[model samples]
Target: MPWGERPRWARWVSVIWIVGFVEGTGAHLLDLISGGLHAYHAWPLPSQVLFHALLVVDLLVAVLVARGLPSGPPLGAAVMVTDLTANYQGNWSGLLHEPLAYVGVTGLLPMTLFGLFVVGTALPLGRAFRGIVRPV
Candidate 1:
């Protein structure tokens, strides 16, 4: 079937994945410059490594987004979960305890966006496949 003839939910899922990857990549670049990543104080070295690793992961997500294939949802799901953990840890590292901590906490915005993307992509994608496999 042609692209347009595909399920509308699938198209929306693709759009969400595309947005997630784009936002993820942009957030990483901003962190590199604005020192926004300092929110991750515990195990600073590993945190930095994970921070950079996400850039690679985001690139992979971008490819999946461009392809708009069924695989995008699962990959985006993984990214969303990872982002949640990372953000939670970063926020709780006592980095946000100081007076000016709000500046660093801004990293959560991308995380929030990631959650939205995951929900947008997964909910509709799940609906698209709801009846695919019948009971044996």
Candidate 2:
């Protein structure tokens, strides 16, 4: 089948999936190149470690979502929710940094928008599957 022949929800989900993957991967790379998570400022070592660990998970979710496999939507939705929550935390913590503060500030809106899109597409896919199994 041609790529666009899939359900509309699936198409939108795939779009958001790619967006998230690119954004997450970009953030991690920026963090690395800037000299580790807290290298710009100073956070406790444990918190910094946990922060980077979460970013890794974020990147993995992006990969899963971008794969666009038929079975991945619901799981990707869950991951997107978690990822948004983490982004929220990052936004709040970002208050501590002056020069880099825009990272958190600018991300808030896109993250919220994509988070909604992920959740929106995930639920319908689940319901559609349920209908398929029931065979009305």
Candidate 3:
């Protein structure tokens, strides 16, 4: 399908995902700016660099996806999964204790859900947006 021919809802989902990606990146950047690099010293330099680099790549993928590229959602989901893996590893223990930490960890649940939703519904949603999946 052509980029301009995508369903409206698919485009909206893509925009939502793009906003989420940008918000996530902005939050991290705010952390870095407010706390300085010392705050992330516990993480290895290479890992830190890789995480930020991936965020940029994710944003780019999101932009492509928002433009109605068929390959965008899967690639975006892949990058999101990588990020979720690293985040889970880093914060898994926090879920065991500390109410504040628990809240913070759970806060990521929505993003995970959104990623899964995008992956699982990509085709159907696309079809629905294109009016192929009509209402009963």
Candidate 4:
């Protein structure tokens, strides 16, 4: 579809995923830089691996979605869901004791929000991405 031809819903959904991946890329990068390989030291071995893997996966999916590939949204969805699960597993008990911890900006809040966004818009974002013109 032409830029002006795509529906509003598609355009909005596209913005949502694009912004998410772009920010995710930055967050993972910074985590790696500041914490080296031990940023997720609080997490289990598997979660730590997944967290590290996102440093590359987030950028890859961001590029793919920027290029308008239809495959990006599903991959993004998978990343968020898995990350959320791992984060909850790692932090649930601690956060439960301090209810206000859930509101922390760098804590589970952003991940939870983004995961919710991906869950809500995954299908529509996939459709939107397919119609997006691939970035040069």
Name the candidate that leads on TM-score: 4
Stretches of model 4 off by over 4 angstroms after superposition = 1-5, 130-136
| Over 4 Å off, model 1 | 33-43, 93-106, 116-120, 123-136
TM-score of 2: 0.59
Rank candidates by lDDT, best first: 4, 3, 1, 2
CA-lDDT, candidates in order: 0.63, 0.60, 0.64, 0.78
Sort the candidates on TM-score, descending order: 4, 3, 1, 2
**Candidate 4 lDDT by residue in tens digits, 20-91:** 877877888898899999988888999999988988888877776666677877988898899899989988
Q: Please write out the lDDT profile of model 2 over residues 1-136, one tens digit for every residue.
A: 1235555655565666767756766776788778864653454455466457656666665555555444456766776676666556655655456535454545666667777877876766444433332222
RMSD of each: 5.3, 5.3, 4.0, 4.7
lDDT score of model 4? Answer: 0.78
Each prediction's total of clashing residue pairs, residues at least 3 apart in sequence or on different chains, is 0, 0, 0, 0
Please, what is the TM-score per model?
0.64, 0.59, 0.70, 0.84
Query: Cα miss at 53, model 1 (Å)?
Result: 1.5
lDDT of 2 at 92: 66
**Tens-place lDDT digits, model 3, residues 1-136:** 4445666666667677778777666766766777666546666675577565754675677666666565666666676777777766666677556536445343567667766776675666455434475553
The residue pairs in collision within model 2 are none
